[model samples]
Target: MAWIFALTIDPVAADSADADFADTFAVIDPAAPALSVGELSTQRGDGIFESIGVVDGHAQEVTAHLERLAHSARICDLPAPHLGQWRQAVEMAAAASGPGESVIKLILSRGVEHGPAPTAWVTVATASDFTAVRRDGIRVVTLDRGYALDVPARAPWLLLGAKTLSYAVNMAAIREAKRRGADDAIFTTSDGFVLEAPTASLILRRGDTFVTPAPNGGILHGTTQLSLFAHLEQRGYATAYETVPVADLSTADAAWLVSSVRLAAPITAVDRAAMPVDAELTASINEYLLSPRD
Candidate 1:
């Protein structure tokens, strides 16, 4: 399906009647062209963004995503975001997105050259179909991130934990995985510890305990994974955060990639080596992820 990029910069100017606006809607457009050629986000990838899963016209974990975005901005030394403005914009787009599954993106960057404030926008678009992959599972391969697990501690300037817009390396890793006939890529440290996927967190099931790499291991603290763990713990399942090695992927009882948009997708194979998995457990976790907390 063709994607509609509806560029509107001012939240107050959202036009709900446009023909190409069904799948995508923008709540803000500042300039006549939306974005300028000199935007730092375009020129230097100097921005932070959050992708939220929208179901039934409600954004899942909006507060969590916004908190992460703020953290990313602080790490990048960008100005603080106007939370009120962002929330309003997101709500506007979400309301116009209809009662279907959609993806909401909150993007903020250092303002365009000579501009006074930050450049921010909220976009709502149709989410991709993940039924087959979510049900059947995926094949994955490990790739070296070329950074030690402790690099984030020693080099804060690297922004290892920040979800900046500079995702070229992450995209390249996934491409290399596809080139090798795999569905996704998991990044391993220079010393051979599992980090995370390009766009999701890794969850390894060892018997009853759910093990995920610590954020200190150079990965994002995934909101979806945290929520799932909370649900599991409330229901008497064990959880842990520790250093996980790539070899563990081969011996784990089950594994999954959890994120906001994809939720919990089982990993059937790692490095072309088939791994044992519990389909019932996978489905149960997915159900919890999709369940309403309130």
Candidate 2:
């Protein structure tokens, strides 16, 4: 069963510090109408969110996800979330999950136009089964993101690094990829540089080193990528972040699209070119990702 909680109190105010958060949030039916008709999250997609992967009822990497949420709030100019309160809310949401995998989303929306404060909520739902996608892998197409590699530094207003609700382009890219007979997409720069996937971070392997695009270039820093990189480093694998060239994709020994809920789905092909899939390494990565982590 799915669960939803509406945050009734201001999530960031200092006065709410000692207040009972149990009462601060109220359970709501997932099927019920909740947000105002004029809510900016729906009207303008003016919000930030984080989808945390929950395995076996434990919300993985809560602190990392919360920190990223705060980072997005800063980037989007949304109100900073109270970490303690949000942490409690995550605990509450995680408890609602049954056995197997689930997803808990933390959303902070700019409240109704000219309203009092920001609107916030937590939702928990069972995640889709990605077992086949993880094992069988996915075919990916390269779509130009229509920006030069230096756009983030040149245009800070783009808000590309923030995980906002404005995902129309991302979704559209995926649809376009499907239209081209592929499962997903890896966004590239207009000047021929590899960026990331529509919904996941791109990790490429060459020999013993694993590399991903530097997050400084308008890419939303991925929590799952970070954890997997750390796990790789611990397992004696070298990892680095660099500005990957588009031509390098074809030469990559292996590649995968890594995300919070989907975990890691190896890329079977890139633009109709068959790319090697490291099945043993892919399975090991997913095993580590599915393990309980704080």
Candidate 3:
């Protein structure tokens, strides 16, 4: 959280598409040639990955990071990567990446030597800029479903906590939002419980406390959102978990679409309704980020 500021992916990068990293690397997808990791194979299936923030040449929250890495691997049943070398992979990509502050992504596919596997994978992605909806605030639309409010309580066997690469559904929602003249889709369950954004967490503020749909709402344990909450708690802002509906989101005093990339991005509009993007909430987030990290 201390690593973020405003509704931005920090500073923008010089270019996004062909952004370079400090180190020589392999851009591997099953459809193309991948960097050789000592014959790790490139013929098998798919895998899952993460995209973490890189600030001042350091990966923010490295501990929660590795845990996420493992979480994804477990989700897809891929073998765990070598810790030391894999971490260096992130550092290598960060160093070799393009100009200005950046966010990095690492794609790790389960290449070759397998029976029944995922098609391919991306381990991580890092870049300074994010595909946020706007500059001042975001314009989001409510999704068709509600938060899976019973994930933890009802279906403990589900991949509720895992980060999966099967993102076609989420991608479709973004397109749908665009069709509706909105930025991104906020997914919910059928019963209408607000869960998360296209790729971020939904953080809404009540009177004083910042509330988010509980993890049981069927949201991934957002690395950025949680880390930011840690900092906010230290700053005396109570962060509570609650079941939020789209109607409630449209009326919050302040709200932001948060994630590891865009630290605390404000949401100016939810669907067609306009809402206030509280200055105090923004200030609190900035103060939290610019402060200090544990």
Candidate 4:
């Protein structure tokens, strides 16, 4: 089952001190038509979005996701999202979720051409059971992302750092990975630096230290990764953000791809080369992820 809500927003009044949000949204029938054919999100993928993991009706890492949404808006030049209104929408979506795992997505799109404001909505739906992949782990292959590590610094207009609606390349990379006999793909810069997985963030574990690629290199900062790092740190594990070289992947003691909905999936193999997996640690990490979190 799924639920959708169309948000009523006034772009010009986005930052107004007296902006009203009491009736800012309305529930919509998922099967019925809600968006226009001229919507930029569908036509040109001109927008930004964030997916929040929901466990037992509780939306996790909402603050982090909202922050990223605003960041994307600034990058895309879309109207700044009213965080308070979006938070209410999240609460409403979470309330509609079942007791099991689910996903809540928030989308703010460039509305119809020459339209007054942007198009925004929230959707809640049941998530697929990822027990097997999360437990047994996934096979991964590295793919070049066709840009140097300095692309974000050099080409800000590419919108590489923003979590925009444009995902053709991302989906194609995953398809290419599958064709190469792998479950997923980890993107690497043309200069041979590790970036991130198509839909997840990469975390490499070396001894007791945990490292993820720095977000400065056009990486969408992972909310789950941040939360897990906090959990790991509280448990006495050192964490750092650094520019990870592709060669470092093979030498890592362990690795996992972390994301919002999928949580943490240990990488069993990269480029068909076997990587170590710590089952006990993976289970513990997933346990913490499955719990209700703010």
Candidate 5:
């Protein structure tokens, strides 16, 4: 899901590789350092991918991850790859995977336009450490350029709802945020309607109400975001799906960027202003995730 090169790695399993990937696509060694995306495979056509966390040798909610991939792919109009092949590849990579935590990414591509069949696959590796995300929280930089949210779902025209391989804008936004001394970026319409974050689902707390952008926000439907909100209702947290103004978040009790990877990254700073995470809200979320559900 993320590729900012790699740092230190601590392995606890026999299958752990030397670094993350000596110089390949996946992580064989977390310490080998990051090579340029020049190595990113281009032989495949555009497709979708899923980032999954494997715990206790079991991939948590794998079906949900796969379902999301399928949804994204279908909307993007990208060629769908065989799920069985992807399963095998992920398992092989996991077998050779490092210890501790591993991020299993399933990347499906149509393969270089050599033929009709799309080439797709999955890669596994030790996920990079997000000490910054875990500690300092997220800094959201609003970008001027924002695409309009296509009201009615257009599975064909509006591939924006899908997680396509063509993420030039998404990646650039994050890079631009860092350049502005912010942790991440979120897009806003020229008219100033706040949209989703580059890599997460936008969320905010107004008074006691936990609110997130409506599905019509036209952003990728995040499983983690949906899961968190679904759990909130059962745990006594009030949540609603609605349109949120960019400025409204500045005065909100708490703001968050949710995703499978970040889980719920607090928006500590927005373009310089700060809004710390609500301690009580954080506790409630942790309790929900750690506790079992029916």
Candidate 6:
């Protein structure tokens, strides 16, 4: 399928005469060159981003996603985003994308080397076909993240909790899992505590209690996970953030890899070890997740 890609740039960042606006917002062609050769984001991967799910012309959880983006920018020492401008940009892209399920990415990168300002843009594109994967579930494998659980607190320079543009290692980890014949990879500390998935958060259910690794352990605070937990709590399910051992996957009644795009995907197997699949629970959680909430 030919994906529809559109870029909405902040008008203040571009010369007024060089840009065009749709509803007072410019949507640039993806094929057009948009960045400088020395853009630090492309050069050294210095930036932060947010991928938000767009459903029926609405950006899901906009406030949470934007807040997290700001937090990440702070960690990277990048200038704070102009939220009004960003909202307009996102609105521009979402309007152009025409309400079909899509992924709206808000990106902020340090501009060209030694440049005075940052580069910001919004892109709306087709979301991946995770429907089948979400319904059928996936198999995952655990891999060592090499960092100890306490590294975030001790070595803040690592920017462990920030969602930076530097995701090559994350991409490679998933590729490694695919090479091993698994659908996804769950990262664990060398000391044996389950952290999170390459691009998602981990959730393990033992009976009625749902547990995941504490965010203080150097993992990004998952926006989807947080929302789902609120719904689960309202539905009378328990949730916790605790140190999860790798072995907990085997003992848990169910496990899920949750994220913005994938939502709640149940893990069918861990390290090729099969687990009980609760079609009922999966359906219920997904129903609640997909339902509109004010």
**lDDT of every predicted structure (CA atoms):** 0.79, 0.90, 0.61, 0.90, 0.63, 0.82
Against the hidden true structure, what lDDT does model 4 obtain?
A: 0.90
lDDT of 2 by residue, 158-234 (tens): 99899999999999999999999999999999999999998899999999999999987899999999999999999
- Per-candidate TM equals 0.89, 0.96, 0.74, 0.96, 0.76, 0.92
lDDT of predicted model 6: 0.82
Candidate 5 lDDT over 146-208, as tens digits, reads 455554354447466677777778889999999999989888866667778877888788776
* Best-to-worst ranking by TM-score: 2, 4, 6, 1, 5, 3
The lDDT, on a scale of 0 to 1, for candidate 5 is: 0.63
Best candidate, lDDT-wise?
2
TM-score of 5: 0.76
Q: Write the per-residue lDDT of candidate 4 for residues 80-187, one digit (tens) a residue.
A: 887877887888888888689889989999999888778888888888899998999999999999999999999999998899999999999999999999999999
- Give the winner by lDDT: 2 or 4: 2
TM-score of 6: 0.92
Off by over 4 Å in 2: 1-9, 14-16
Supply candidate 1's per-residue lDDT for 175: 95
Q: Model 4: residues >4 Å from true position, as ranges?
A: 1-12, 18-20
Question: What's the distance in Å from true for residue 59, model 5?
Answer: 2.1
Pairs with backbone N, CA or C atoms under 3 Å apart (clashes), candidate 2: none
Candidate 3 local lDDT, 176-267, one digit each (tens): 99999987778877776888887888888777688888876657878777888887788688998887776788678888887766667788
Which parts of model 5 are misplaced by more than 4 Å? 1-45, 79-98, 151-156, 283-294
Per residue, candidate 6 scores C-alpha lDDT tens digits across 106-200 of: 88888779887777777777777777877899999999999888888999999999999999999999999999999999999988898999899
